[model samples]
Target: MISDHILLTLQVLPILPTLAATNLRQRISAFIHERTYQAPPDGHVKNVIVIGGSFGGYQAVKRLTKTLPTGYRVVLVEKNSHLNYVFAFPRFIVVKGHEQNAFIPYSGISKGALEGIFHHIQDTAMEVTERFVELKSGARLEYEYLVIATGSSSKLPSKVSSTESKYAQQELRGMQDKIRQAGRIAIVGGGAVGVQLVSDIKDFYPEKEVTLIHSRAQLLHSFGPRLRDLITETLTGMGVTLRLNARPDLSSETNTLKFWNGDEEMYDLIIPCTGQQPNSNIISTVSPASISKETSHILVKPTLQVMDDRYPYIFAFGDVAATGGPRMGRAAMFQADIVVDNIQQLIAGSRNLCVYKPKFWFEGAIKLTLGKNRVALYIQQENGQEILVDSNLGHEDGDVKSQWAFFGADAEELETRKI
Candidate 1:
């Protein structure tokens, strides 16, 4: 036993040197934060209110809390008990265990609120105004500065099940059960969600028949050809039937689909990933002028202030803002930073306001995970050329790992931790 123990220790020692540096770094970083940190209490009176605590809302509120002083009583209102990692919703619907990683609790948001700097309210905003907002619970909150970052929503499983955490999980379970039992699955739209849904199903159940129908000839139509072509190849290789340039006229009564090419098909499971609508209902009361009649997105000035110039204190961003840009996480954060900076300027009694200029396509950038161990990074060069770069991200088991670490909407310890 002694001889074996010595051999094992020697074998582990060689590997320990490699991991020791990384582990030591994480330990040192954690030690410092634990020594000095206090999380703001949950839910409080409103001086500055932020609605919709997702990517844009969370970033905006966190930045405000870190920057604003004692006089500012910041409040964050979110309908969901936990922040939902929407990008992982597709995989969660098609698999098990992944749902656990999608919803992150709000309790870990700030280390603990000194100086009335942070508060959270798990409530829905029924209506909004320049002065106050009415909650669904019939409670009204007054605010000096208001930020609407409610983002958008799609069908269940594609997003979250509901605002309630338990109910949402139950809904996800039901969807997962349906997916397991269904013989043939039909996913409409070649957007990211739809593509991910079909791929996830096919990846797990190669025997199951899966079809992806997109109105456009290409997948991820917003991106350039190379990326779309790569996705098409990946799906085709995965045994997915792609119906491009064929907008199927769906009949709920008959439960059948008729394509433009006169082909008809039926499926045991039908998932419509299209029609992601903004949760801009609050703006209807506060600033109807900010609502775009065509797109239904809230219109904001270059400074990200609401369409009403006079009501500079009220603002909107994230997916709700009509910035004519892609609704990616990075883009939302960009808008959030500008909004927070501009808010700081005004709060400091400074006349100069920062304007939000949309970045070029290359600067925005997004990665698409086609399947396990298959990903393509879409980027634009300075010369206005777009390219889909190859990736070595061997993500197995679930597609939500890296995203959870980066923007999973949970991880209180990691939220304030830097490494």
Candidate 2:
């Protein structure tokens, strides 16, 4: 009972490990090295603190460590114990036996970036001041420059538990149990997460009744119309009940949902696959004018620096910045390139500053796994058309290897062995 008039904008969007050292002296030397190294007493070294260890923050810290001049220490502050590789969350959360691989150890990143140049702190940021970030642990990390990349949060299972690593694992396992127990599942918000969850759940338990309710007429409203049609077809073909242009009543009970269309449904479980909301409170407090009330993003220039001229040195990106593009992981990585380059130019006393140009379209490339075997990819074509390709990666494809094999992936692990 959805109308075609609500066809509007939707942006589709888009995920480490450790290793052993070669020698004993090198191992000892590296073991003693600090991940979040401090400057010398004489203040010869500059502190480059990057908050958030997700895709963008990790990339920023990695770039700083490899490119920054010597004596400039890179510090990454992440509250989580491990970098949860969420790319496979849609699949891994549904299918069993993949939970162990979902989380990559935060230890042993930046194979050759430099000894003692990069440091990691397992803590959360409570506020941002002009000179430094105040941590929840009552520690102040002073920085010559700061990068905010605290990405948004979503429902658990789709997102790992927000607590510590062990608890996160337990939470994921708990969701697995719930998925197994629930005969009827309702997923709210038909973005990438909701659609993908429908496919994943159907693949895992084909007999279960799974329903996806989207508020927009088009599932991925920002994506090209072609992709939206394809998603609708695939979801229905795979046995998911699709409800378009429907909003759930907030006052409904825990297990029941009443829709805006005057329809009500009862399910054993309901999961909200929400989109990213900027974690901009800390920086917004410091420079209120730098944030936009509309999008909850810290207003930044194209160079990714805060709009407030008084604090141009502070930069924001990823889900936290109003960057005028789809907030994709790759987009954040691209922003890191510009931020790091500009920081380099600033420290080198060079007038040339690199402006950031997003590589992906405003919505980024559309990637969704319809089922264990069916994968769909959407690339933008010229004149506003979209090239849609569907492939079957299959449940047992060899190409899907653990991504931690390469260095500088996942922005270097939080912990690394010395040497």
Candidate 3:
């Protein structure tokens, strides 16, 4: 044999080659194995995604996340940074004198603080595909369950301005300034919004002339004759001019409103508390079949799931969804409960889908502040009509405090999940 050093070197060289060959063979085997067995579907995890983060959307996301299991993911995609309380819009216009009270920052609901139960995506949704939603930023989110709670937007006069929330706030401020400067204000539309706004304005500025113009012959025609007469009488007593069956076509410049009616009365300001259109463009793009032909509202099954199988994973609620009942914030919250229940059932692999029954007998309460100490109350009846009730008490009097307490409880629940 050769010397000991030479003999060792030769043995080491042969072992190195053997090790390299073995490693190469293992790599090749793994590659072949990977190719032979395709990767499993990435849709394994159960995900619940909610689009929109306003009142109805926010409540839905909060309830769903609270009710969902630990492993399930809940994603809330919202374009706005804050939640605007639309119900308080009139109050902001009258007392608070600004729209700031309507907006609340959404950071109150943090993901890490909630143990990562929910994810907040701050972006506008562009398209909703069969299994994914494409964001405006080109990011795609895949969801097993989807909730579309996009609400409605106000349709104002062309001169009034656009729907930019900032612009809306500016417009409200302008209106407030005009209210202080002018002696007469005319409000068109006798719906809840119009009536509430007029009530608040008259309550604060009692001396100012407030005229309510309505196309209908009576106030709140939908609520029946007795209640309408009562409300009309109340307004008249409060020095509010009620012009029923008066259709005034509006023409506005920078400051004054000219009515097309024969009177041709010039108003210091004309506020159109007209109707609203559902923000259903995204739904239309995603599931056109799910929307009703007559009303742009989305049609959903009893389970709140979209009627089209293409979006069986998608569900809708709020004013935009046709739930076969009155579309109100309260009703949306009620439907959210059913949505939460059905989503949980789906995740638990249960075939049972819960039906969402509209509470026709549910009487919605209405409170309108007429002046510093005067207010009006209207409660719905079993026959789907609003009846005039007493409204002399403040928050501390009678059931007023209890009513506020209930509202606070629901608000706290909503606040706890803000993000």
Which candidate number maximizes TM-score?
2
Candidate 1 has an lDDT of: 0.75
Error of 3 at 273 (Å): 0.6
Tens-digit lDDT track of model 2 for 38-94: 435445777888999887887787667666655788889998887777777766667
Question: Once model 2 is optimally superposed onto the true structure by TM-score, how far is the C-alpha of residue 35 displaced, in angstroms?
Answer: 20
> Which has the higher lDDT value, candidate number 1 or candidate number 3?
1
Q: After superposition, how far is residue 344 of candidate 2 from its true place, in Å?
A: 0.2
**Which ranges in model 3 have alpha carbons more than 4 Å from their true place?**
1-46, 97-99, 111-113, 155-171, 251-263, 383-388, 395-419
TM-score of each: 0.83, 0.85, 0.76
lDDT of each: 0.75, 0.74, 0.67
RMSD of 1: 9.5
Candidate 2, residue 151: Cα displacement in angstroms equals 1.4
Q: Which stretches of candidate 2 lie above 4 Å from their native place?
A: 1-43, 251-253, 396-400, 406-419
Q: Which ten residues in a row have the lowest lDDT in candidate 1?
A: 410-419
- The candidate that wins on lDDT is 1
Question: Comparing 2 and 3 by lDDT, which wins?
Answer: 2
Candidate 1 local lDDT, 167-264, one digit each (tens): 88777778899999998988988898888788888988889999999998788887777678878888999999998887887556554787778888
Model 1: what TM-score?
A: 0.83
